[model samples]
Target: MKLSKKQARLRRATKFRAKHAEKGVERLCVYKSSQHIYVQLISACGTKTLASASSIKEKNGGNVVAAKKIGTEIAKAAKAVKVTKVAFDRSGFKYHGRVKALAEAARDGGLDF
Candidate 1:
């Protein structure tokens, strides 16, 4: 049977996460929705979120601009807590459009991934 779109995304996410688990480093995870983009810096142990940022407070959440802002915010937050490097986990989303914008902005903001 063919998997639905959401199911397919989840399958990809599971596979990505499995590989991420082996790295044993902090992870920068990004999740995007129709109305918002969320990002989190998770501890290596997967027990804590070192930092998080979202477009929920912004007037526009569904745009590349908003994604970039969230990425900059997340990078600042991570640095304030002394987090410099992390694994980028796109949560099964394609690395284009908003996701790409966010990642580039984060890099510009000084987070290495």
Candidate 2:
């Protein structure tokens, strides 16, 4: 059976998540859409979200700049909750363009992922 693009991405994501789960650290999960990007800091056990940010609040959602803003905001929210380190979970998206920008900005904001 041939997998659709979305299915294939999910397969990859599931595998990656399994590996991350083994590490037992909090995760910074990213999800992107045509109009917005969302991020959440999830507990190691995956039962709760510690912090979250999204581009919906920004003036522009579909740009790299907005993603960077969301990333920085998420990092601040995480720090407020006393979380400094986390595993980056790109949700099957490649680590480039907006995704890369967000990750880099998060790092600059003192997130140790």
Candidate 3:
């Protein structure tokens, strides 16, 4: 069966999750929409999310600036929860625009990806 755009992205995302799980590293997963962006820090076992952040909380997660702030927020929250390094799972989205901005922001905020 054929998949829609979001479904295809999910399918590819499952593979990335599996790889990260195999490595037993926490993963920083990002999900973006037209008006919002979400990020989650997943445990090494892929069993739970350690932390999460999004632009929705700030009412402006759609742009690069908002993406960066959300990234920093997630990173700080992860550190508070004792998480350090993490694999970056872009959820099949290309590494540019908001996604790239968020990732860069996370890195600058002290996350190793």
CA lDDT of every candidate: 0.93, 0.92, 0.90
- Compose the digit string of candidate 3's lDDT tens values, residues 41-109: 988988898999988877666889999999889989988998889999999999999999999999988
**Model 3: CA > 4 A from native:** 1-3
The regions of model 2 sitting more than 4 angstroms off are: none
Lowest summed lDDT over 10 consecutive residues: which window, candidate 2? 53-62
Off by over 4 Å in 1: none
TM-score of 1: 0.95
Instruction: Provide the lowest-lDDT 10-residue window in model 1.
Output: 14-23
Better of 2 and 3 by TM-score: 2
Worst 10 residues of 3 by lDDT: 54-63
Q: What TM-score against the true fold does each predicted structure earn? A: 0.95, 0.96, 0.91
lDDT of 1 by residue, 1-113 (tens): 99998999999988877888888889999999999999999998788999999999999998999999999999999999999989999988999999999999999999998
In the predicted model 1, the residue pairs found to clash are: none
